[model samples]
Target: MAAFDGSTDYDVTLEIPVSIGGLELPNRLYRAPLLEHAGDDDPVDRLLDELEPCAEAGVGLLMQGATPIRGREGRAAPGMTGFEDPDRVASMSRLTDRIDAHGSRIFAQLAHGGLRSMEVWHAGYRRRNPGLRQRVVSKPPLPLRLADRLGILSIDADPLSTDEVYELAADFGRAADRAAAAGYHGVHLAGATMGIFQQFLSPFYNRRDDEFGGALDDRLRFFEVVHEEIRARTDVPLVTKVPAETETPWFVRESIDAEEAIEACRRLAEIGYDAVVPVGSSPFWDHAIIRGEFGSRGFDDRVSRGFEAAFGGPWRRRLVELAARIDAATTPFEAAWNADLCRRVRAVVDVPVLCVGGIRGRSEADRLLGDACSMVGMARPFYAEPRLAARLLAESDATAVCESCNNCVPPQAVGEPGVCRTPAVLKQRGEFEKRGAYEREGGNRRRDSDGPKL
Candidate 1:
């Protein structure tokens, strides 16, 4: 027998069929979960249009972006859908129908805002609840060790009450049922560190004396119950975006480093998760997820201006800018940034592992699928060009034109559908209207309320 040189199998590895639960994925390239803002956009028609190209491009697996479990409490952005809503189910059905036509397997990536809830920004939903960010944790829990306090882990956000935690678990289970009804092949829990699931799992933000708090087992108790409930409700595949490695050391250290993440993933896989998708700490280590030119935030011509406005003046404005700059500071753009992380994770779990980070084109995909991970997931590149996968598959030498500018991220960050700002997306009034801002043509006018929706 000949020695297996890595290059020989590169072409076929990504093309091979793999099974995710009962769902048979036709290829190794799954579209990373991303927001189409169909929840808030024209809901049905616009989502169909936005997803049409990706489907036509021939991706076999497409994970639709984050949908909140609770309509108001967990909404990270205004446009995010609560799949339970009748209008949303109809819309999801329409979009899923379009995807099925192209022989694609689609899943809804369900999320709960948890502590980072953008409920503060929701216009219709905001007035209903007392503002909770500061009040809930009016006193942010102090990190137990001096080492843990070194970075972004000091975030002072209120912890969910013991009841709220269990309620959230039930919400996720019911949400999964709704996702199945909406024509998705499976449901995904957004356990990435940025959202509530990770918040409950990480000690940095989850400081309470209740059963949901304390040791690692206690922190994960909420998730164990949620996982058990979701599995019982649906037989569809369940995937989770868990931390493989924390991006910046401070946030993912001690309790949940690379070793801890693997251990947790190993246990979760046993608990019934169909696959584990690994993510570096997001937002806090902004550049890790979306790398680009140094300090080049699209905020001035982008979404999130409303966030800046909340600061109210030059001092706060300067502070926000500095924070954004620090968070998004540049890292060298690389191919398959998370391949090694995925390789580490693939070693421990028996379930399929999906790796996504800094994957730009065919070459990177091949590099990643060559054994580092079972699948390669793409997000921003597709946002930059919907035909991204087709282009890569058609030409082995091809690469994405995305500058990795992170422009598309902010839109979905708040809950607006992605808008490619490269050649001026704002200039297209017809396209802009579907995204729910700009009442007229031309980029000349702006809406009375709401930041760019992300």
Candidate 2:
């Protein structure tokens, strides 16, 4: 990675075209993957409605949020499109076509949420569906076991055998093949965010002595095998999200640190991953990734209605809420939080390194593109302003209006679309109604008052 000497012009630096695995993007700005809860009813249309605006607004690359490679069994939440279904994959061509028409490349982000799946998190759902169990790389951790014992979280899981691991990797390959058939320009593996890949890589979860665990090289075998599987099935460019567990609970001594994560990124590059997005994350679901103060209404809604199934009883919900408040206090938002981690990863890997995390303005994006990374990405900001790329790409000093209050996050747990719930933001766009801006709506359609200009 070349160091910026503060002499290059920001506009020129950000506008320079970059290529990843023979796929060329028009500019260095990308929309990072954020789950679009496209419901089962016309899911393809809903996905297109959510993503096309970003492409039309001139985003260089768009990563469709974590799509389950398998059926409902691997889903992290409700309303995710099942790429494993051939019929569903075929319908996704319309989305790909529209995005391409805007000259923007879209990548299908394939993922399976291991222990983080609803089977482990949503207690009521687990109770209603007795057969559903979370698939894990190893046994459930102490906290999870305690939670289950205390009736806080009901969880049942089976550790994947070595053979089953290979089968799961094959599923990833099949998903990539489906993505290629659907006309996506590339594939992005959701390896971070405590997903299945992270379960294998992080010692906090991987407690096996087989070929797929123990040393760092062995722990990385699953990813290498998945990469091989994808390569065998499709020739599209592959990108992966790598988590640097830089922040973890005080008791967690086995988490992957920044150094190990950097090495992991280097290994992924060697394994032929076209690009790596190294992010600052924790072993647990907390504010480390989506950093910001919690919105009171959002938190209340999450506990009272949205995530009632996830947190279980009243006492358990209160415990989880306390934990979340503590997390927020400890992990406050910082703009360009991942820039240093990305810079470190870039120093070793020959492939493009993408940076994302609390980056909200042109100056931050420009500085990152100038020296730290090959591309800069923003996720939550896109939820606030779907057509954000127009201003980001065209203006010299544009900044997003999203306050990063995290008000839009909670509803997704219950199948709601990602939308701005902030009163001021909605009012500014003239979408706030008497029903309240945070009210659950049937669809993700923009109101008459909303447009690309916002």
Candidate 3:
């Protein structure tokens, strides 16, 4: 059988080193940030052993995901670092030190889940309610008015006071300083709809009439100020993942469509973002981002749990499962699902653009790198093969074992690390997590005072 290119092969060795935000990464294969939190409280302890595999695999960079910035305001769940914890900096530095030892550049993905609260804002809602669309809290409740009319998860959020918004921007800068102290090569501030940064941008979440909302430019003030502040604080590279103007359903108040996303990429590029990663859908709503066959099906049990909690008839139970399945369904598996949008972003900015969707094996990656993208990121594939990068460099036909099952995702907030659920991968993940536990108690790793302070 003839491969698409008529050449049954792929290669990463010939790829050129590219500079993003002044950090010249060795190759284009990036270990996309996946939310593999190290249990609830001892993240720093388990991080080194958990991440050592990827660094040893010869990945160009390891982007640790969802490093929360503030205390209550930044955290989405336990195990996430908010940089406010006294011991977090020391723990983060230990993780970075391990990466440095393996010669892999590292970046902490800074984030704050804003209106997207883990705690239900009101008594009526459930945990991290799936689509908590809101109106400005000071104003009359909008989504609440329609809440009973529809079956979607709708709740009210306390809109940030103008003062609070500005303070959040300052927090981002401080967080970047902390990352630098931790020996990271860079930091990618998460501006996804799931985070505070996106809460300020998407009209779905931002409903204020003051300086922070209304027109697109007005809404963008937060992004501009936050990134500028981060630049002021650190010399490390800055990157972000955003919706890229992809249209999301009305119920999901966290995303803006395709054209809006293009404007977003251009605006961020102007503000000195080292790279912009454009995913297939808004970070919160679309199943396409994970490229799941059925709306992140192998995961999203929370959706059903929330629905069951809200309306618990046997009929509701059936409906809940059906809705979750339908909600997460997407197109068939295809490589570079976000390539088109990324190309548009590339045309607008000189900075590198990263496209992540389903760049499964070497072929898809090589194809996109040859086209619009500057780099490629794979999240699920890494779980299937931590050594996938090194393996691919040696064998063009080396494919990742990850079937995009997505079983490792929609993370276990309080429990286990979200490791690959495939039987074979599951076994390996158990062994890895066990060793990570041992390292946590070894008592010789770096402590808070041993690392730099912000």
Candidate 4:
């Protein structure tokens, strides 16, 4: 059934298999978690020695970014990484035996920055709001979004009282059963930037007049009861990352439109959500429009064709012919226009469409496996080459150098960790302080005390 001609170059052992649930991923080229305030409290030998050179750099699905779940004022930092500590699940079983001995499949991005919790980057449990205001309330210079920086540090917000929003929908199904009992080959729900499911799909921090909020079906009824109690506990794999709308007017929200972000991707494809990733966040809504972010680049196939026309489905003409083969790239020249937009978004989405922004090397990872978007996420070139899929299968030019350097999503380096002032991550300050700051309390808002700092 070979029909994907986005331009062909993939063979990390013959690409093609993305399967999610019982973890199949051999190559779709993923390594996008970056946030390296690398899991604190005895973080297993500095996160398996910075993921053993990123699983000897052959990435196939090496996730793990946000982590924190069972509260500690719902962490976002103080150097994140706490799977609600049950004695730190053997630091994720020594990070799943060195990413399954380098074959690659480690998943764990489960976050909870709710209202973007930032007590000077999570110094720990300060949000105790009774709407008593004045924690230093000034806000309005505009760049304050993340539900107004989690309502000026009025944490553990009161609005969630529908039995604490069904006890945070069973604490997101017991934090996805503690990242699938810590073997993790599944569990990516950090619902983009102002995380905590985009602060329960923000209506500017859900004023919650009940059911959950006022509209957008009561703000996706607490994410459909935390995706039906984390898909009823778990068969592993879930991956959600939404927010193409509703955040102080970015993707232009009218009660979270685009048919409610395609009815929240047809309710994460009716709850068996294997993958969804859409992300786009620079104006305060989980951004979605990909790299350029002002809007339009296959904005997840015109918003998954409004969730394939509200689930009438035929995969909505394969997600609008993979957004006209990723709007036939007018720029980002090379890697055959990203394998013809991943062979025109895998010729219409049978479930694989991945691609995340400004890819790094191996000719954009061989046009991201010659254009079929099964995987190729790359958060800021894995904080300036974390062995980027092993220097792109050793064709090395330092994997065609990624000096784009926005300095991997800044925000005061969350408390400082992912320090790649380039020069190859500053010749390892003890592996950049044991691999930190991929983005825990960094850029999602903080510079405006009086604005100046660029």
Candidate 5:
């Protein structure tokens, strides 16, 4: 398909080099962040195994999944590494060297899970390790608190004091400094997806009356302070992911809509952010971020292990699962789902705008790159095909094979590597493995007999 007016080739459009905050990337395709779940094992090696293939295949940019800025207390799930470890600099240096050797720029995504921390969500974890409560911007909404009391939700939260807010922002800066010292090309702040930044920015969470809350501009002060702190420590290019809470339930009146999100991006650009990634997200975790068919297999597998550990009990687990199914039915997969938001943000911001939602095919990506966004990104697709960029850059008709089953997501909360688990995809990959496809050609080669195709 043509990129624009049947004049520009889609392949050429995707292959075009772009500069983001002075970092000249080789192409417009990037690997969006998804947890690797390296566990207590050698995380650097596991991360290298998961990310090096994308870099080696000529992916332009790789955003390492959310790494905890603090120690264990900051992790959202198991297997997440952090910057607080003394050997983090050396370990990260090794990772950066491997990606840079392949000429791919890698950015460390610094994050701190606030309300979404495992301490709040995982009953087993919290019980096993006491005294480490999940930190929050303020007390959770009344409904959430009531749910906790009624045994419908497991929430143990510690509201951050006014001074603690600044301290957490400095932690972000310190993480950025460590990332720079580790030889990363840049740092991507986890400003969305229920992280600490989102807790501050989303009115659903931040009810504080201090300078960090109340008005939208006041809520955005946390991000501004974080930007200042990072800049004070290092000069690396900074990128952030901001959520447009477009999918909030109808009953939810106070949320960040498209206009507010656009203004937020404008302010971020003004504060010297190199680029912005605008995604459709929710203050609460559901399938909105990775919208698709609910992976009942993965969810059942996780819950059957021990529902009480994650959810309050079997009944609560069933209720949550039922809600997820309904949510999936309401929000089915739509390719390039964030294109409209990216277009809106791009219209006003002078900086590059990157987008990632359900962009699967070359045509969809080309359409977005033609006018909507400066760069296109995908997360689960990389899980299905690690060397996806090679084919995407080589063939204009290329489409990722990820079925969007969402099976790769649930297992991560239980400390499993984010790899494609769809049986047909796995069968195809196994056939390729037998033929030594990966060893011979970096897994980019495709045969007509390669089982089922997407």
Candidate 6:
């Protein structure tokens, strides 16, 4: 509970202020946008229940994970909650109050799955063609190598057109408007994982030859339109998650170089974005493992800080000061540094920074304030235990730990609403075994063939 042992200067009140548009935030700690397949039909409301716990955990900003804006997609998971209906808007409004009671601001991340949409898979494959052969478009199609990329087992991809693109952007804005109406602090665009945004941005995915394709500027147009719409319609903050660039063992072409990422960051700043979060394996490496590995070590932080460094503008300056403050702390990672990326963004433009990934301690909170981060975010750990942030700040003796179990990693290891199945989460989930049956099946089957969690 006490940030320090009377040794270093540690501030417990992580109520750091950050400004986005006209909104001022409380601190630098946040709950990363984590998807909880808690739907209208589920017996338990997964993410909705975590709001208060996360607020109690002292999260100044608590943002939920990618909730779809388009209702047509249906439920990827049997009970996935969505923002497509007016009724759900009221439900979210009530949910926001639960988080607000804890003094933490709440936001909903709006998204569309695009090519990687699980709904498309479920409906196209599971329901329509369970026994169909694999089908995929090869990046470099050639003899003897037709099946290069993993086939998603679906025949329902209708390449998006410019009009459709515009429509979707508006849909995103509409969702943002709804979230704002629901009293969310902000709404972030889920641009990662070849999501709708990323697919448009990446040449690997987008085949459009119109104004929405080609150059990076062209590719980023779809996002710009959506962002502009959100800003024009609502007063809520806007944040985006981008992949950083790194080239260690592999080369990531779309992975924007730090400098390019900075340029993009500056562009977003100019566009009036509150924060830009970069998540993934070294942004430098084109090789992303498991569709979710940021490498086991630095992962998200390294990409975030490193990218901020590459873009040394007003945004960079804010992030730098914030980073200095976070580097001063003794938490699992540098909260300020991660937040600094946002602060630096704030300095140049009129916005605040929000850091995310895997934060789970007050040490992180102290660092966020001490460093200068407007807000820091916790994801997987928080996903496993909704009240995790509260326990770290209020319960001094509480030594909660994320076993780094891959339960929360979706599409790569487990299913949606990844449960906490690590020894710790298992103890918490009670039905960890039942929940982790998939892992057990994969692990058991793999052991016979000498494989891994993939």
Q: Where does the lowest 10-residue lDDT sum fall in candidate 2?
A: 445-454
After superposition, the stretches of candidate 6 with alpha carbons farther than 4 Å from their true spots are 1-13, 42-45, 74-79, 123-152, 245-254, 281-350, 358-361, 364-373, 394-400, 410-416, 424-454
Output the lDDT of residue 118, model 1. Answer: 58
Sequence-dependent TM-score of model 4:
0.31
Candidate 1 local lDDT, residue 28: 69
Distance from true location, Cα of 436 in model 1, Å: 31
Judged by TM-score relative to the true structure, which candidate is superior, 1 or 3? 1
lDDT of 2 by residue, 1-454 (tens): 3322323244445556777898878777899999998955568878888998788777889999999887767678877877888778878899999898878889999999888887788866676667766778999778768878877666677899999999999999998998899899999999999888888999998999899999888999999999999999999999999988999788787888999999999888988898999988998877899999875557665436656567776777777777777888888889889998988887787788899999999877888876678888999988887877777766778787788898877677777787888988765545422423323222122223222110
lDDT of 1 by residue, 1-454 (tens): 1211223245445555667876776566778877777665457777667676776676668888888766556676657667656566655777787788776778888887664565433333444455534213113434322312432222334555667667668878888887787788898888874677776666665666888777877777766888888877888899998864355546444345667677677777777788888776642324655566443444644444544333333454455456556666645566677777777767777777788878777776776776677777888766766755565655677676666666665545444567676664333423533653212122112223322110
What candidate 2 gets wrong by more than 4 Å, as runs, is 1-12, 300-303, 429-454
Q: Which of the predicted structures, 1 or 6, would earn the higher lDDT when compared with the native?
A: 1
User: By TM-score, highest first, what's the ranking?
Assistant: 5, 2, 1, 3, 6, 4
Model 6, span 1-454: residue lDDT tens: 1111212224423433444555555544566766666665431256556566566556567767678777646223333467887667766767787777656677788777664454334432244434432221112212112211223223344565567677777888888898888888888877664466766665555456788877778768887999878877897878887644322223223444444454566677666666677543232112231122222222134334433332223454344335433322312332223443444433443344455554456665555444434455667666566655545544434434555444344222113344554555557544433543112111101012221100
Give the runs in model 3 whose Cα sits over 4 Å from its true position. 1-15, 121-156, 245-247, 250-255, 283-286, 294-320, 330-332, 410-415, 424-454
- State how far residue 191 of model 1 sits from its true place (Å): 0.8
Better of 3 and 6 by lDDT: 3
Relative to the unseen true structure, what is the C-alpha lDDT of residue 302 in candidate 1, on a scale of 0 to 100?
Answer: 41
lDDT of 6 at 4: 13
Candidate 5 local lDDT, 69-169, one digit each (tens): 88767688877877766576557788898888787899989888887887777778777878786788888987678768867667767888889989988
Task: State each model's C-alpha RMSD to the native.
Answer: 9.8, 6.5, 8.3, 21.0, 5.9, 15.0
Instruction: Give the RMSD in angstroms, all C-alphas superposed, for model 1.
Output: 9.8
Evaluate model 6: give its lDDT.
Answer: 0.52
